[model samples]
Target: MTADLTVVHARTLTLDDALPEVEAVLVGGGRVLMAGSREAVRGAAPGARVLDHRDVLLTPGLSEAHIHLVTYGFSLSQVGLHGARSVSEVQARVAHRVLNTPAGTWIRGGGFLLSELGLGEYPSAALLDEVSPHHPVMLYSRDLHMAWVNSAALRAAGVHEGTPDPEGGRVVRPLGCLLENASALVARAIPAPTEAEFLTAARAGAQDLAERGYVSAHTMAFEAPDAPRALQRLAQQGELPLRVWACLPHERLGQAQALGLARTPGGLFQWGGVKFFADGALGSRTAWLHAPGFADGSGTGIPLDPPELIREVGRAAIELGLTPVTHAIGDRANTEVLDAYDALRPQAQARGIRLRIEHAQHLRAEDVPRFRGLTASVQPIHLQADGPMIRSLMPHLESLSYAFRSLRDAGAVLAFGSDAPVAPPEYRANFAAAVTRVDDAGERLAPGEALTELDVLRAHTRGPALAAGWDDEGIIRPGARAAFTLWDRLGGNAQALVF
Candidate 1:
């Protein structure tokens, strides 16, 4: 069949090692027909429409390697407290939201780091109670692994001072916050959004990523099942702006297998991985660690999924044609996950499935090499905030935190993302964080691990492509996908230009 053709002319970075740069590309049938000089492409596609963008820099479309899609959409409308520097500041924000919101409605917001709040210790419920007495309120830490709630919210979730901490989580003293699984106790009390709400959130999130120059995202499965359902609906309706590679929580493995679900890829959405959390996050003080844990003597971070469980369930996931994606943040967590992956590696390789470790954030020097063939799905944007914490809390391991260069040199595929809502899915922030290796304290953390602008861009584009097993999407080459991101300069002002 004859193809409808168009010629796109720009200062193009093909990202194809074979043909690294091009002046023009001929696109047809949603794929690249040829990429070379304008005259050559024009001759290759006679009668093709010419869309010149000579002043712009065109590269393969960007991808968000990790994010919670629908959740980020909802966060767009929720109270934002990412930069709150003091307890009074947080209270002020909640007070403002309270004045605008109704009395009985639950108020939700997050994005504050404990270290940034100038509180040597965790804030108590009284702080939020003073600002919001009538409405139940839950404010998540920047990491999302912990939640600070008011008295009303604590009562609603039946979490009191005497309540025993659930296994794999904690209920802090004086009843103001919940950690790890304990956060779920209160979260379960929050009303679930309707299908329509989910759809709206899904649309909002996907469009937000597209607007930020991301052509695709790997929506990590920490959200409700309705989240993926909403995205699927959008894809079915042809309204999804960014392609999504989503995962199911390991808890849903049985249900998925019963439903005969497999690695089905097409349209704008696909399910390719089964997600597991090996430990909690840093800001939450629950990141499972080895000896001499947090400098504050908080003990080694909490471990979530046991190594035994990961091996068992991870194998089951691979047997069913899914990638085993585990979140390992702390050094001990990475060690345990690497041990688990060791046994599963043979199975993964035989089946052509890539084993993935999300965050792989803090690692022991020896464990770095274990990631040689694995995908290190990381968020460099976290470094902008975590740099100070790493110095103050885990100084002994500072050099190994966010070890981008080490992982890359060892052959691990570096997939970059923002872990959005936890942080904004802003590519510029990512570029700055990865390239500068500087933190909020104006100090560099492992400057030796800093990446070049091109390296960061590749992680945003090619790395995600490798993770999603999409050889066609991250390069501008003959037979590649016709999606492109135009930038005024690399890592600068950008927009998606997908055909």
Candidate 2:
């Protein structure tokens, strides 16, 4: 049944420096054999089966550099609140869901930003209490850094007026919300999904990404361990469509080592990094910042992992052949992480592993250069929503915020993603956010920081490919994996084409 070759005739953008553009590509055995003019490709493989796509544009398959795959899949079935602009709207949505389901069942959903809700202050339990007094309810802010809960759920987790805040997190006053690690108090009480449920979610997530033209993703770990297990099961059954590079939470490093886990590549799924958080996120008012933080006087945000621990564990992770991927949002967090990475850089370089920083969202100009030789895994889609907040909260650092071009010019590899479940994995939004530099309010936060279309494309493709150590992907040339995204135009309607 196998053909000698599969000749794809289209406007191919190889994304290779040598063969930047071609009219046709001949693929066989899941790898590209020749890329050149139609006649040349036909000459290379005379008996090849031809797939003529004359008007379409073929480029390397897109890669989502950061996402919670299973979490996003689960979110698809939950109550959606991403565009809810007012507390009343949220109440209405929750009330509608409450009307359909039986009483007393746990209700969970998220995607509302505090700023978007037009709340002058932290929301109270009374708001949600008015809607679902009998049902336990927990909702997450847009950034997933904060949780909003009703009184019923609060009591279930044993949180009370006298509950002391956990380290690296806070219990907001009046018993309504939790920030950072504090959210885990209530979250732990929620029943875990069964293995079958996990497998279903994994399939849903991977298939969704593949349908959106993504050939691979880097699933950051913050979920139950069962999440990656589901992915592994899918890979074992040969049912996975997208290539996945998953990470383990640093707390599970011991468990990973005990299980004899190491960086094992060349499969549909692989473990490539150990994830650590240096600070919380912006929407939660918990992004650890420098002095004069939050123009509204919220004080410098909370820090999660201590720099010393990051340095020590990071060295161990690198020595184990895993990338030390740290999440650093605020300027102070970035500075501290940079300091830690500086100490571990020599060892990482010796091991041939490039350390990575997720959410390098905000930075100090001085620390910008320190990102040299590091992977800045960022979500430009956040800029569309975070623009006004960045201005209102940290005007002093406005110019340096989301400094994509600056980091790239200073030798940092820019890997773009959407941080799904926080924001939908919509590549068009990423393209618009980075290329236009315009926000929801129609204001340009940092117009000078805008990137060219090609620049953004590379970040979404080649950058992620490098991060995952997949030399054969994210390019369309001889010997490269025959996975491509056919686009109507660059950054336009697209679909995945995997040979």
Candidate 3:
């Protein structure tokens, strides 16, 4: 058998509309050579290495549409708090980590929900101090929008009662929390990872995704400069397991322009988009909603990047052949972003750039239609935790929250993602959350918006491919990349099959 040629026999679900299904596929030189009946494919590749997996289902490889991958990789080694149901549980976890960590060492962890913690008010610094006073501890909310730090951590950061909130963030009073841009206030004090650490994290994250059956990822640009550099280094060394389409933070746009940066293609790692944040996330009560925000009396959430900046710089991004990818979680944020895009859409269309909106989570009914031609990179698994929040906090827009079907029907490319570190990159959870519409509270959230399993698969595969301008990666056509995900059954256990 030739090293570069292989024939895979399986129940193939070729996402290609032209050929919905096939029995086997022939692959050579990292691309699909042919896909047809097993006998026909065998006839075409007589000497190819044959992988007989007729019992499994083969589909186009999965793609993680949105993730702070490097950060997620680092998180794997830190304290995991994804399901700590109460404040005591959070404290216990922190104490456990501190037991082994050195005294006065900074402890970092996250992935807890305010609602899940069962706290009526913001958790106080005293709560954590009771567990780990010797070591400074800071745990991020599940959304990464807020940081819950102990008094020691706060003192180390010089945060005090009189300390004013940062321009786009808040230092919650009584001194236990930092919100939005305020996270950096404490983050600045923590030690930064070395370049080698970044490289290790990059490898760990990429390998984790590949092991989870993803062939590619669109890593959002919310990480440190070294993070992407780490991924780039992996790609250059030929150690990267998944193809990556990365974004540059909007703040770096000027420098990128000066360096004559544009979409650099051909490698497994490519610069594909410019990312912007219109608002923060929901878990932290920082989403920029309309009037009567956060029925819990958290006030109208903070807005970050101005829509004007997004509109002006977004055009420049498109001119540089980069898609303008913005994070808009609240209805108001979406409306403002949609308004900004209304002006930039012409330029985007001219350049064949599809504007991307990450976390098009909550939308005004009118704004849903605005997403018609844009990419709605939403995370459905979030619905599992956010269902009750939507009911209690933003019931006014409950019906339109995470409106997957409406967005898809309106022509918005439905790109599903994990936003890992916020949630794990589990496609099975995505399938269940999207198809079931059931949340942690056992309540259905907008069941009418539920998607079929096939729809979910397309969102995970083709939608991300189109979003990243990866025309040859998401389908199983002759010219498509020979990367696939084998499942015991569709949406079941996954294993990557890359030639």
Candidate 4:
């Protein structure tokens, strides 16, 4: 028998540091069988079909370590506000969507930053009402920390000036914005997408990722439960093209445990982590800081799911063999989560599970080194928008924001992603932001913290695989996943392919 397929005459970047570059690769059983000189491969598999791409550079396939997969797909069909630069721009976009949309239909969109809107002050519901009085509109900020709602939408959710802020969140005074869990009140009012809509969104999200050279993604479950289920369905039907590591929100930990869900190994998809939020995001001024917060006097940011709650639930996750993945974006938030992790470290290590912190953005100096050995599931692309905000709001900690170099130096594993839907999963953007350390305003938050292309590549590939506890997917070597990204240049345009 000729055995399987072979890809010959390609400049394969094996990513095995000791002997990194190779001339060709052979694949079988959906894994890399051999990677070396093309002539050697030809001698071994004389009759194997050849895919000649000697010019293209092949590397391990890119994996998005943190993303809301299905949600990113669904957002494509919903009202989109990603590029709105000003409040007027947001209003205009909402107005445009409302015009074409049916009456009484709910409007939803996200991916805007308060700073980008030039709002020195919190915006009121009145701003959106001007353009959309008849429609109920709710738009989430890029951070997923806050939501902006029009008056009609507020009233539809029965939120009035007297509405009390929910614990761990707030319903802002002006009746326009809802922070953290409060956003859910308004979100609940929107109609859930139908099953067909979900399938469409999943396909859209997966295709978008594939188009960007991603062979796998670790989808953080900020989306509804049905979202991950939809992904699982796709994988079961063999329709999913990318490897998926799905997570459950912490609230569902008990449910998952009851269902006897445990760490699933070896497949196109698996359940590997339980996700939690320790605080909100900086863009929405909800990231919990220590003290002396924004220079402009926005009080220490809002806290979300408490560290204690995370710790309590984290124990259960460990027993179930699921990694504890928490979103911690502020100095205080990071500090608290670290405290909890310190307490759980023993158990986590015993179970051979890794602890992951999403958006380990801002940090207290004393806590920097503590991240060693943990997975810092971060989005370098967000630094472009967050850099200016950190300078203005948390100036004291500016040197530590997105401290990629510091974290990596301290022995932390950095898994980089674009946090798509929140930002496009543009690997080029990630490469640019991580390597250049430039923000949207053209100012470098911390030039010293910038990483080189090689460093960024490791985080985008190796780091994510390590976090998912998959030693076989990120490296292009024998026994490794045959998935790969063929980049024109290390940091340039690329295509993803899986055998």
Candidate 5:
């Protein structure tokens, strides 16, 4: 007996249509050699070593379809304020971090919601200054679409009360917050990490995901150039755990084309899409909406990359055999993106490229059908917190928000992710949010949009694989990759089993 293969005996939920459930899977050479009953598997791979997990549910490995990997890794150490309920609470947390951190160092952190903090207006820089006047601070809102910088940070970035706002972004009055592109004002001032530092962060992020049962992730391109380079280094060094699908910022499309970068799929890191943002986020009240903006008098959110730009660059992306991915949160943004995609759809389909829309968070009744062939890369966990906000801010769109079932029935691929660094890569939260359709306030936001446990599992596994064109990674079958997540209970705690 060679003892070269391993037979994993578990109650398997194979997402494969032919045989949806299997009692055992024989894995070798990082692939599924055979999957069937315990008796059949042992007979096929005689004397193979057994890794028994009959008590746990074994399904295809989990994938975090959207995350800022390196940033999240770095955020592990920053001051966390994810659930602060008041301005005083936020100040206290910042003050606590200042006590331990050296003076004059940048104090960076995020995960706060204005609604949670009962904020009617953006906090003034003075509030943060009250806590850490000596150290420069830049805390992001929960959505990562806004930044709250202290006075010292404002000065460090050369942003004064008189400084004009940058194009397509806003610099709030009283000098505490920056929105959209304006974030670059202070962001450019932050020191860039060395290659070694970048590598450290990349490792931390990837390892964290693997420990939490994710075998793969799709890292969004909303990061610096050093970000992906560090990931590549990690992959080459054989230290990377999660198989990564990377994206290039649309702003760098010219540079990418110049460097001959397109859909280069190999190894652990693969570049497959060009990323764009059609609007801001719902939590930020910056979502680009149609007619009568936010019900709360927040103007029809700030539009980012224009639809014209998406159409132009999207075509070029498709021509290079890459998918064009856009983030659209509001009805108007979705409508505009859908319209732009309509023109680029035929060309994309001709090349076997699929158009993807990230955070298809909101849509009109008429716009739901328009998603028929597009990939909706959405985050279910977001629905948990954004429910109350949706009701209060965009009441008109509440029925259509986070329409998971609607999108699925319309023939759209629903890839789920946590949008980590904004929210933790918490699949349990995703399960609760998507299945219950319950928000933070305990009210059901869109109950009709809810999905079953199996549906969510498929979205987290198979949907992401299809979106990234990694055909062998998401399902559990004879030819599929040998990656599985063992859960004590479905949608509960789990661990990855990878050959």
Candidate 6:
């Protein structure tokens, strides 16, 4: 008998069963043919080419449940301010980029945090100007809610001191920071990438995720419309190595509807969700809060997208068969989103779509159960950097921040991700952080909310698959995809094989 493929002499860690071990697995037609004792497999497919890896542990392929693939790809080439300890360090990097670039070109980079830069206040444009007075420069805070544009960039964008802040955004008084929609002012002035650039970014991002053992990713659309189109191009050209569940930003819903975009299952890449933001992020000091704001007195943070718009668009998303996923980082943001979701519950259920809240990061105890039937697509790795800020800013709610265990107990489906570009999608880092709850400061933030290794694996695998509506993935069993991750251990070294 001719057999398609055989993986023998390996201990399979099938997440489907509670036994914690299986002998081997057989693959055919890009699906799991069988999984059982190695001897049983050899007897069934005697002619198959057997690749033995007895030393390795095999489980289902890991998935990043949330990420911005193209942005992450571009970040690989941009100035990264993620670890810059001071404003001088950020300016130095920007200066270096400016020196190397041609005149009149806009320097685009991001991933700095005022907290990390050790600045009690937003850095002034003067700091960046000292480094690159002639070149237009825009540096985004790590959370992405705010941007610091050098004077040249501000001039290029036509933003002046008298330019009133746009609705749903704020322009810091000193003209150094543009929040939410206002950041688009400077961003619009920057050059849009060519189609080739987009394709390169998509391919690089997909390859990078696959190299890290991610067989699939749920790419949130907090990016330009061209980004997802680039991913689609890659998929069509067969250059995409990872399965992608893409999204359309809420602002483009009207265009998507006009173009007849809807959920497309059973494809290498598909538009499956509508993305919205209820507020900004904690690290950026813009995460919308409740009455008792940040303990450090930054005041209740800024709210971005209104809940009413979420309800209207969310309904449209459900009617069109796309899941609705919102970015809600603070307690108030989460609460407002939940209220909007509750208003759409019946419709969401009727459409067979699971509502998702990306970064469902911090929460009020009372709002915990509101996520009962939703997917909390979260990035545990971020806790490493945000832990101290979380403790200082919202100390009272620190226990519920990244509350993986608590969310699971509250009946929320947890889907793990890296939110890369914001942070890299490193599964090992995620495993350690989620399971250990250790932060950059070496302090354990809400240790009581930590998940077990198994829980982490399950969230990273099966949980994301479910959220993506892929029933035939995230497991080692008959009728499942041949995608598998070979791990040194549950949360250790890993590699992926998607046959």
The 0-to-1 C-alpha lDDT of every candidate, in the order given, reads 0.92, 0.92, 0.93, 0.88, 0.93, 0.88
- Count of clashing pairs, candidate 5: 0
| Candidate 3 per-residue lDDT over residues 127-199, each given as its tens digit | 9999998798989999999999998998898988898888999898888999989889989989889999999
Location of the lowest summed lDDT over 10 successive residues in candidate 5: 1-10
**RMSDs, each prediction?**
1.1, 1.0, 1.1, 1.2, 0.9, 1.4
lDDT of 2 by residue, 199-260 (tens): 99999999999999999999999999999999999999999999999999999988778888
**In model 1, which regions exceed 4 Å deviation?**
1-3
Score every model by TM-score.
0.99, 0.99, 0.98, 0.98, 0.99, 0.97
State which candidate, 1 or 4, has the greater lDDT: 1
Residue range with the least summed lDDT across 10 consecutive positions in model 6: 1-10
Better of 4 and 5 by lDDT: 5
Query: Alpha-carbon error at 138 in model 3, in Å?
Result: 1.4
| Candidate 3 to truth, TM | 0.98
**CA deviation > 4 Å runs, candidate 4:** none
Kindly report which residue pairs in candidate 1 clash with one another.
288-301
lDDT of 1 by residue, 180-298 (tens): 99999899999999999999999999999999888999999999999999999999999999889999999999999999998886778999999999999999888989998999898
Candidate 4, residue 376: CA error in Å?
0.8
User: For residues 1-499, could you state the per-residue lDDT of candidate 4 as single tens digits?
Assistant: 5656766567877768876989988887788888888888888888888988777878889999988999999888877777788988888888889889998888889888888888887799999899888889988888777899999898888888888888887888868989888998888878888988888899899988998889999999988877888888899999998999988998888888889999999888899999998888888888888988867787888877888888899999999999999999989999999999998999999998889999999988899999988999999999998888888788899989999999999989999998878998888888999999988889988899999998988899889999999999889888999899888899899999788
lDDT of 5 by residue, 324-437 (tens): 999999999999999999999899989888789999999999999999988999999999889998999988999999999999999999999999899999999999999999
